[model samples]
Target: MARLCLPDGAVRGIDIQGAQTGTVTSYTAGRDGTVTVDNPQHERALRQYGAFPANLGGRSTRGGYRCGVCGFAAYIKTCSRCGGTCEKES
Candidate 1:
């Protein structure tokens, strides 16, 4: 004998804005619209997770800029730690 199982009224509709993708292992939305995911199974799903561009304007303090090559934050034009040039103006 075989049995069939189906969701009756317990299942509710979900409104996801990123992408209609693979099964969700975890989901979270911040008050500031920040989101992150871990261990995304599908490539498309992972891309969708990071589809939104982060608003990075006015986030850094009045000091320096991050190094584009090595991702170092400093006040000087060149990063002392990684020796990378600062691309972003602070």
Candidate 2:
């Protein structure tokens, strides 16, 4: 007899946004309507984990933006890649 096992989590999507993707910048994740490329070891990490949303626009502020390891909650300056501002803008 053969047995089957399924992963509790699955990669959702992969999107290549921004002007120039030469060096990736600004990575974040949230519960709803949030986008992120989870895989760290792989270079082509455009996949996501959360369920895709219907009204991505209306979910403003309801969700949050955080670094791979909960960015805003902690004090993290200068993005790892381009050394940019990770703090939220007013």
Candidate 3:
């Protein structure tokens, strides 16, 4: 199984094999912004649609910055919420 972290309102189409036929399935991100897929096609499709691999360790594996004032995390050096400076996370 593969775990992906989807942004809010992200959706993807997947192909699934049924008993005698195959069908295209659509999946949407849940409230926690995560989805678990067992199919490789689904994983690839989700990644193509802007979903990234989830890091279970509670830290981003992509290496980004975090806002010092509002605790927001992103790749930008400035915080979008609190208008504070963001520091690079080690």
lDDT by residue for model 2 (1-90), tens: 111111124333233344454553443333442444343422233333233322223233233332343333223454554444555422
By the TM-score metric, which is better: model 1 or model 2?
1
Best by TM-score: 3
Model 2 backbone overlap count: 1
Assess the local accuracy of residue 69 in candidate 3 as a C-alpha lDDT between 0 and 100: 90
Q: Which regions of candidate 2 deviate over 4 angstroms? A: 1-75
* Model 2 residue 28 CA deviation in Å: 21
Distance (Å) between predicted and true CA of 23, model 3? 0.8
Which pairs of residues have clashing backbones in candidate 1? none
Higher-scoring candidate on lDDT, 1 or 2: 1
Measured against the true structure, the TM-scores of the candidates, in listed sequence, are: 0.31, 0.19, 0.47
What RMSD does each model have against the real structure?
Answer: 13.7, 14.4, 8.8
Candidate 1 structure quality by residue, lDDT tens digits, 1-90: 111111122133112433454444433334444444333333234344343323233354245577788666666788877888886564
CA lDDT of every candidate: 0.44, 0.34, 0.67
Please name the candidate that would achieve the greatest lDDT relative to the true structure. Answer: 3
Q: Which candidate do you rate higher for TM-score, 1 or 3? A: 3
